[model samples]
Target: MKLLIYCLNYAPELTGIGKYAAEQAEWLAMHGHDVRVITSHPYYPAWRVADDHCGWRYQREQRAGVTVFRAPLWVPHTPSSIKRLLHLASFALCSLPLLAAQWRWRPEVIFLVEPPLACSPAALAFARLRHCKAWLHIQDYEVEAAFALGLLKHPWLELAASALERHALMHFDRISTISSSMLSLARRKAVPDERLVYLPNWADLAIAPSASSVALRSALGIPAHAVAALYSGNMGNKQGLEILAEAARLLAGETGIHFIFCGAGPGRALLEQRCQDLPQVHFLALQPAEQFPALLGAADIHLLPQRADAADLVLPSKLAGMLASGRPVIATAEAGTELASLVSQFGIVTPPGDAQAMVRALQALAERPARRGLFGAAGKAWAASHLDRHAVLARLESELRRLTEGGGAGTRGTTLEGLGEK
Candidate 1:
């Protein structure tokens, strides 16, 4: 099968959607499928393009058997609502020629990743023009999230954007998202039940603690007995990371508890400023892929904080890694949401943005080594059963094959029965 993945982020971005997008493309390529990616240069979680990819021109490269085409875009140093839209628009406009150039390739499936739903129209139109299937995999519901998070406040604009979103969504041959709640949202947007697919994010269960894990802990100067509470991945507005700074401040006198904030984004500078006076807090830039597993293993507890409004709209991709790391997680999520339910199974869930609750949860786990061990074991077990990368990708490949073989469009919605509970 020949597949073209259109998305705004891709490889070398290290965390979030890019990591998964690149992984999927490479997996498909390795599995005897022809995979190509149309994406912008590495600018995610950091909001700045990598130095090597800063040139304002189109470039192509081969990565792990996959053909990757990088299109240049404007990345805002300090991204605001308007700036973010402009940023996404830049990619959509710049990548058009690249998309058009693929006319001769005539991919069997055009798998579009959302967040820059800005590119949806072009992707859909191109798929129609080539008589190929158009598959949309939504990692984030940017239209709804923007309004819900107050990133865009005009009611009229919200209505207009939502209408446009629905129009684009209704035209797709297949639509997949990372969570059941998101799938439900797609259905609410008038996407037929038969078109919705639940494609959950997956984890690499093969990752394990190594010598580098100990080295990382030592290098960070975490006391031998101290509990490391880590919040790793993008430091973005939707993360509600300010609560973490507050939680760290409240726990400042607890010498045996340390906080580590890793990864970069528009919110990192503010988070650093807020934590500057907290001696127990430390920060690190996003680690290399080779060191990521070690970084996960170094944490005694993983912290996942989400803004209440952003909850359910976007599930953090980092959760899979945290669970796979065999570490206890303390996540801020509302009751009844998928994130809360999942974390409650193997870790702890506090109401979103509740610093006091987060602090309490951290303190409770800090003193209970046995309980921590139980949670870690349970989380690892769950990840192995439900989030193994091979299983998830194999299912995706099967779906792609089915779609290319002309069996997907009218099929019933793929149930999550074996993957996990709805």
Candidate 2:
């Protein structure tokens, strides 16, 4: 099977969709599929193109059996709604020539990653020209999320943009998204059930912790007796991370509990400013991937926060890693939101932006070691069963193979049932 993955982000981005897309492409190649990825240079979580890739308009390289084609993208120093749109547009526009150039080496399938839904038409054109199936795997519902999160608020513009996105969505042969809630949103956009595939995000179960890092608590400056509540991942607007600072402020007198915020993003400065006065808080930069297990293992609890408006539009890809780390999570989500419903069994949920509620949840967990242990164990077990990386990718590969061999359109939504069984 020959597969072409079209995404704005790819390997070395270190977070979010890029990480997963790179993994998927490499895994397919290793499993005997001819995989080719067309993507923009790494610029995520940090939002700046890496130093070495600064001058290149285009670069092609082979990484572990996968053919990678990197296109130039306009990176904004500080991302606003319009600037971010331009950023996606830059990549989409720049990659079109490359997509057209791939006509000779016709791939069996062209899988597109959405965010820059602006590129859908280009991908559809490539698929049409190549006479192959076009698949869309959405990492974020950007159009709706923009309005819902107040990132873009003109009523007329919202209607026009949504109409355009809806039109682009209908042209794809197969549309897969990360969460059931996200799939439901796709359905609400009038995408027929037959077109939707539930391809949930997965966890890296193979990560091994370093034995020497067991003293990570002391290394992070937290005392042995302090209960560390950690928030680690991209600090962005959608994260509603201000609540962490508020919760820390509310619990500042509780010396037994400590708050640690790790990872960098546009929101990092704001988070640091907000929590600067709080002595119980510590902020760390993103650690190396190999140190993930030890870093995650050091935390007594993990914190995940999603804005109320953006909760359903995007599922935090970081949640899967946290669950796999065997640490109890405390997330801010409304009572019946998708995240709350999904995590109810494995972690504690509080209303979004509610500092008092978060403080209470943190206090409750910090005082109850037995309850924390139970939640951690349950999360670990669930991740092993549901978020296994190989199993998820194998299922995806099988579906893609069936789609291509069966002549394009899949078994009319049958993959959803298979996903449910898993």
- Candidate whose lDDT is highest: 1
Each prediction's number of clashing residue pairs: 0, 0
Q: What's the lDDT for residue 276 in model 1?
A: 95
lDDT (tens digit, per residue) of candidate 2 on 1-422: 98999998888877888889999999999999999999999878887787878624899999889999998889887888888878878888899888887888999899999877888888888888778999999999988888888888788878878877887778888898988788878878888877777888899875434563457777767887789998988888799998999999999899999988988788999999999898889888777777777788778889998999887889899999888887789998877777898777878999998999999989999999999889988888888888898988997988898788774443344332245452
Residues 304-405 of candidate 1 have per-residue lDDT tens digits of: 999989888998999999999999999999999888988997789999878999999999999999998999999999888878888888878877887888
- How well does candidate 2 match the true structure in TM-score terms? 0.95
Worst 10 residues of 2 by lDDT: 408-417
Clashing pairs in 1: none
Residue pairs whose backbone atoms clash in candidate 2 = none
**lDDT of prediction 2:** 0.84
Clashes of 1: 0
Cα lDDT for residue 124, candidate 1: 92
List residue ranges in candidate 2 displaced over 4 A. Answer: 207-212, 407-422
